[model samples]
Target chain A: MTTVFKRPESLKDTETHYCSGCGHGIVHRLIAEVVDELGIRERVVGIAPVGCAVLAYEYFNFDVSEAAHGRAPAVATGMKRARPDLIVFAYQGDGDLAAIGMAEIIHAANRGEHITVFFVNNAVYGMTGGQMAPTTMLGQKTETTPRGRNALGEGAPIRVAELLAQFDGVKFVERCTVSKPRNVLKARAAVKTALSLQIEGKGFGFVEILSPCPTYWGLQPRVAMRMIEERMEEIFPLGRIKEPAAEG
Target chain B: MAEKHLMCGNEALSEAAVAAGCRCYFGYPITPQNEVTAYMSRRMPEVGGQFVQSESELAAINMVFGAAVVGARAITTSSSPGISLMQEGISYIAANELPAVIVNVMRGGPGLGNIGPSQADYFQATRGGGHGDYRTIVLTPASVQEIVDHVILAFDLADRYRNPVLILIDGVLGQMVEPVEIAPPPAADLPAKDWALTGCKGRPPNKSRSLILGENELLEMNRRLQEKYRAIEAAEARHEAVDAADAEILLVAYGSPARTCRSVVRKYRERGYRIGLFRPVTAWPFPSAALAECAKGASAVLVVEMSAGQLVEDVRLTLGPAANVLLLGKPGGEVIQAGELEAEIDRIIGLHKMKRR
Candidate 1:
């Protein structure tokens, strides 16, 4: 009887190429909703990474530039610097942000570039056939780590939000998830807050969304969502990791 | 009014970049090219521009990629090893058809060889160093003045063609100081960048991408790129030929080697030897047609380089089998001395005479 749920105008009507129950679709919807609420869709520039979301440009109803793998932050830095009037953000996966692109993410965060970063940490390399990503949890099996991720050899899963929180240049850092409806609401809020900080010209803002990768995790969509709720959340704890100090 | 000052080649190029309306510069500090980075760090902010000392060459080039996508005149500088690190981003810039200027103040390499000047990257610069079928417009600037001039030209050509332009210099040209008259910024009218990703605003959203998974789609993209390259080769092939009309031997060189070969050619000509110099300014297009025309009157072509027969391969390709193209190279961080080049030329000439007899 009431029209409540509908697609955000900032999101395109095209069908997404994401796998069934993939967290990317949820995260994309959250970003689109935030962009729509802010009424900045016309001036927003999104940078798509080389991971599973490489085709993110097709789904967002705004100008998007696809960057080389792990170079999204640097690209976002360029976009912001070249046109500070526009809003810029980089959407990257764990492998694209924490591994090959580690240098780019760290330095961009350190430089305090006035841009937002939407980091989708699914704990495994989803696009490249479930390879062992830098955020691959210990004892979690992946294509590269068929016998499960060995802590002694492959090292521990990188806590990117915690790592970036230590940087002084960062104004805000939050870790949220889209495992359930409530968590999705929190992620949407975090995304909105991060974008708001960029609008206010505060500093670099980062939101790490612990997404589900059912195809790469070798589980059903519901099972992967449960895994994120019970297991992945323990490894990568949720909540705000950093925030700017209050003005005196 | 034009300003004249005694400046290092690196600094001169940085100043020229500012004059050419490059507002964003991203660079990492690498030897011999550090001056450009340092200069831009100070000058850019002073002129309401942005300068970022990126953590690595990889980040710097990607930053340039980002700025160029917004239709901003952007630049990055690095040395041999640093440039190697930037190959991934360069390839991306080429595939995306973004206009950015890159300066490679080359040093000896295979792996962190030395800080001395070297033209060993001629092949890397002219040929596609990064993976993919793409070409960057490579300009070899020999002197501080040419470095200044080409820095301005590199930006214009990059925007003109919507592709990356590389200024391939070496440590000597980067560090050497010379009194150069910085010209007024050119008044070349460039087309408005209506395709840049500045935001959809009043139109349908635009996507800037290089990845095409579909076979037909990828083929069409490559076809378009090849057409652009062919157009560039036809129009942008640039070289300087001196006394090539009736020369007995033509010396082919570029960058620093060209500067040294010029004096060698002069000394030989003063002694009544019909020797001439042919230097390629635009190295990527290779100036093949110009080289062939210059090689017509000459009995043989001698390619003197700092690398082990890299440019010589291009010379041979351009001149074909009928033309005698010989290589005289000094590898392993060794700059080709004028006297050594002279001796090689005389030895080759003597061998030619013996064969004729």
Candidate 2:
């Protein structure tokens, strides 16, 4: 008998608390698979952010620390710097990464901390009843943006991958989506590359996953995925934003 | 390593932390405490330790939290405003039961107050500062030599209890320069942290978190935390009672103000006033039992602090109407003067004498 598909050993076999049609479960499995593929599960230390995935520690079958809101990058730096032998990564949402934690992310990148960052960009604050997030599209409607987000009043969406790539300390920065199976595979590859860079002792590697939040986006699960491919992809172009510096 | 050399309060404290096996220091530059950050940047590399001048105090404390999560001895130093910025992380660390050292060389504050020394943060430090029912072990060191000794003790206490230990000082102690005797590391070994998140290699995974959504579960956690605090209160209250027995006037104080009160005790006792000084070292586990016992025979108990009147509340609560509690609290970054305290003591004595007649 052949068992081709099963859960990754790095992911705990249990039910998660994520909402129906959310993209967090897919990304969590992708990370677990990536951890198993690299054989770094034993050495990996993950940091969970204060968001919908705050219970990531329960899903991740590895050591994990829960960080205060927007402080996961700094926490990751501490873990990595204390024991460089450990592979450390921070799983953050847009509210945790691009907004309140802007300084921590930018400075961690600027400092060239040998760690990985998995930034999930869902455009709206999912856990907090769909408030307008820093990455929310200019005209997107949210709880706070009742009429629609206005460029003059609220500010445009942030391109985190592009912003982080400008720093010399960052070794790799990529923006990918999990809108479709093909896009999911690409995002998986990007996650693997980011983790591999950390194993190789290359400094900061960041992957911005343009994830779907159907409940917050006020769309059906299938429609949310389609919208990510349509409107979200148009604003946040998916591809490798920055490549690792070439080896000599 | 001179046996006895002059050292600044900030640098000596930094040096003592490294000697106490602290290898990771994350801090932001702030007034009256910048010397601590400056000293760490220069000393850390030499000792093969890590030093990070974090982007903000928030990042610095979180870095400390991160380092401590992995069983690393980590510390972060800041002043009043910087410490305020760090409250969020501090609350998390305290609740998570992680071991870390926090040094607050406090300056005057209500909001961006001034770059002068004050102990107005007594309530903030003693009452857990941030929004929570957690408590931090606050150590008040009155001198450079004491700072050296207490910083070392702070690390051990933090690790032993699996909680954060705060070294509370102001500009007076943090900036003072004096001869200090830096001691060798203690003979006792640090307790093994079986719960540290050093990776789940060949073991069950360890998760460090404080989020408990279950109503009953959170109540149980809070009950367990209260039990731990009760154990700490029983085991760790420390105080120094100088010439307190058989005295009519007992002076209670901490930090540099305690020094002024000590001087007042010495000078006034010679002039026929039976004055004494009680200094609380561990301010959170605030030597309350010893204080209540010491205040029994005294005609009056006076609390001298650099704050306006925070410590007086505790003294009054401790004594109730059984004793007369007076406060000589001076705010605005100024140290309480010995002369002023002495005059207040004379007036209290005069009032008592008239009441007896």
Candidate 3:
């Protein structure tokens, strides 16, 4: 019998520590599928950021380095510049990328470091008990935003995909979500394009995955998916925001 | 020996690092260590190594952390305020067990002090500047030639112990031009770093991190670090003494102040005063035992520093009250004049003789 579905060789067999119904797990699987498809699993070195995905190294079956909070891009820049032979990528969360590590990510992209960055924006700080994040939507109630995030008190959610797409160093930028099967397929494709850009010696590639956090959003698993579709997607639209020019 | 040439201390260090097989440099601009970043920006590209001018000192150190994870010979340089920004990354590098060289061309500080030289960072460098109970091997090089030698030594020791090595110089040593020999790269027999993260082509995947979520695991990690520090302290402490055995007055110093103490020792020796100079090359392992040995016949030990007696604390810790430790300190941005230091030396010896009579 021909097997149609199986775990990617790039993903380990161990169970993940991510919460059930979380979008991170789905996004992780998509990245693994792309890594296997591209046949670049052995030459890939992943950087895990300090957030919900801090333990991502355990699940990715390749060389991985755990970065300090918000410094993954800087780390990836160093690695890629030194090796250039290896495929390097950074897995980061909203707090890790948009908040404390803003300077690092901006500079890395501006410098045109040839690396892939998979940014998961769940809108709430999941591992840190749902504290307000940089991408946290205004009027959303979080641990720090107990009375609901006020636009005057807190800024509006940051559109990272659009912000990063403006840099000349960045060659590809996409925003996708995994709230449903149809969207998951698009996200999977986006992951492939981002990784492929690096393989093609293109500059920085950024994919913002508008993921779901059932535990922090105070909704059922299915309902959390709906919230991503209904609310998060409003601020973070899903589609390719920027793409490298087609080769002749 | 390579050809001798006139070189500034910061530029010589950059050339020495390139010769030492340094493969990557990530840095930000900060005086008086700006020459290092500028020199590396030019030299690294010429040698086919990578150089990145990071957005800030914090980013530079993390970039060093990244290069180190891949087993590259990575380095970063900055002055006092910039080094303060680097403390967090340094702590992470230490915990992650990465080999990196951090050069702090210290200027006067508690703030954006000045571009002038000072040794006030003694306590910060020696006492694990950032958080945690870890230690970094600190090397205080006094002159242009010594800075070149110590830059190479810093890299070797960093890789040897799998810990960060800090080269602490003040603005004086960082900028002054002097004639020095830039040597060729030695045939270094460094140990194999089997732990570096270079993709798992045919072997099991490698994961390197310092986050110990388990309390017991963190305890074990701390214990292992302590053991390694003990090993480093025993084997790596370096010091020098001139006529220490026959001295009644021992003047101890490091970095730029040591250069001044050398001249003071010569002037006192010409006057037939039993004086000697003790300079600690490696500040973290501290040369404590070696210093106690050098102070054996001395009646008084004076620590000459650019700070408020920071280095004197370590001397007192090594030799208690009987060593009669004195301080000839210049707080923050100024250097100690040779005339003042000489006068202090005379007072220390005169007081010792009066007490004996």
Candidate 4:
């Protein structure tokens, strides 16, 4: 028997510390694969956000920088501007991007900085132990919203992809889920698309991956998939919301 | 042969930057210094360089940080209020030990000061405006030509020391137009950056950053930085002392206000007042030796500034209590007239003569 799939060279051989069945590991592998496929592994610089992915530098073989919480876009902007030839990306979680870094990410896209952004939307804060997130789904139960997220009390879940799609500076914007094997493949394509946009010298490209935190979601791998498939997709429909127009 | 051209102080700085091999500029629009950005915007594209108008002062400075990380010849200009917004990125640049030039065509300020020539930011520029135990080499350019030469020198010194250099001009110098000879362009063999993050492909992943986590590591980094600062002090301290050989009185000044004092020096020299002028070129390392030398046998030292005698304290530190130091300043939006400065000079001379008699 032979395995057709192997980890990308961009990813380190070290084991991930994420919970078993966590989608972060899957998304990380996808990003690494994209970086390798695009041949940008050596020229790629990754910015790790202040989240569970804080130690993302340890996992990626490429150059990595740690940014203050919610300031990854600002850091990425600096990295990209300083070395325009290098491929830079930010790996951020919902709590990091939507909660604290909303302004930074929005402004980065609005400014149309030529870089890629990989946003992981897991509905709840994973590193801080299942607290409420800006993207936490309504009626979803969490440590902070124990009786379910009350819309009137906690406000509504933020749709980052939708918000960023409105900005003219954003060259590419897409949302995909990693709840199942099919959607995982879709996410890989999305990641590739975003990276290719940057490679083509197009402005800001973003891919929002709806991921799952099994331990925090208090569900098994299969049950989490059901949650993502049934509920997450309803909240965040998949497909490209913005794409660069063909120059005639 | 060196070429001469007529230009404003801001245009001279921009032309000199191009000649000095600068290829990138990221800045925001601010008053009294819009000319710097406008000049760059017109010249950069023609030379295949980058000129970006960043969204805010915060974004512009960070862009400078980005460009500096990769060893691109980059700079940004802003007025006093914008400079305040750039303190964080400036601190980051210093902490990382990246080489870049920053032009602060300063205006009056503690907050939102008008777009006029003022030395209020003397303390902020000289004593590390940002929150960090670090220092930036600040150059005060009084004339349009100095602004041009200093901007080019700033890039060289920044790269030489791998530290940020601030070209501290003021509204008067920035807005003033005069005859300036554009320096010849640097040779094509300008220094190349090996530490930049330009694709990390040829190198073994060069990591140029400022994050030191452990206490011991942080302390060691600080010590190393202090050593670098000392080396910079020894290597790049610059000042100008005029007609101090047989002078009885010395006038200490810097920036645009120093230009006013230069005129006063000429007038007093005609009236038989032997007053010399000491202009600090590098405001950070200052010109302590030059100031000390100028005050050697002088009976009195006068500090003329547009601020509330900020540089006076620095002069006092250099001259000690032996010299009778007096501050002649016109703070709060009033320009220091040459006649006012001359009167103060005469009064000081009259008082010293009375003391002797």
In terms of DockQ, which candidate is strongest? Answer: 2
Question: For model 3, how big is the iRMS in angstroms?
Answer: 0.7
- TM-score to native of every candidate shown: 0.97, 0.98, 0.98, 0.88
Count clashes in each candidate, considering only residues at least 3 apart in sequence or on different chains: 0, 0, 0, 2
Per-model TM-score of chain B? 0.97, 0.97, 0.97, 0.95
lDDT of each: 0.91, 0.92, 0.91, 0.83
DockQ for every model, please: 0.88, 0.90, 0.87, 0.41
- State in Å the error of residue A225, model 3: 0.4
Give TM-score values for chain A, per-prediction.
Answer: 0.98, 0.99, 0.98, 0.97
What candidate 2 gets wrong by more than 4 Å, as runs, is B354-357
Which candidate number maximizes lDDT? 2
lDDT of 4 by residue, A1-248 (tens): 89899888888899987888888899899999988888998888887777888778778877776665676787678677656788888889998899877877888899898989999998999998999999999989999999999999799999999999999999888999888788899899999998988888888999999888888899998898789888998988888899765654
Q: What residue runs in model 3 are displaced by over 4 Å at the alpha carbon? A: B354-357
**Residue B154 local lDDT, model 1:** 91
Looking at model 3, residue A104 earns an lDDT score of 94
Ranking by lDDT: 2, 3, 1, 4
Per-residue error for B3 in candidate 3, Å, reads 0.3
Model 1 over residues A68-113: C-alpha lDDT tens digits?
9999999999999999998999999988999989999999998889
i-RMS for every candidate (Å) is: 0.7, 0.6, 0.7, 2.7
lDDT of 3 by residue, B15-69 (tens): 9899889979999998899899899999999999999999999899999999999
Model 3: how far residue B322 lies from native, Å: 3.6
Tens digits of per-residue lDDT for model 4 on B217-320? 98999999999998888878899888776668888888877888888878778777787888999988977887787788787888888888788989998888
Ranking of all predicted structures according to TM-score, beginning with the best and ending with the worst = 3, 2, 1, 4
| Candidate 2 backbone overlaps, count | 0
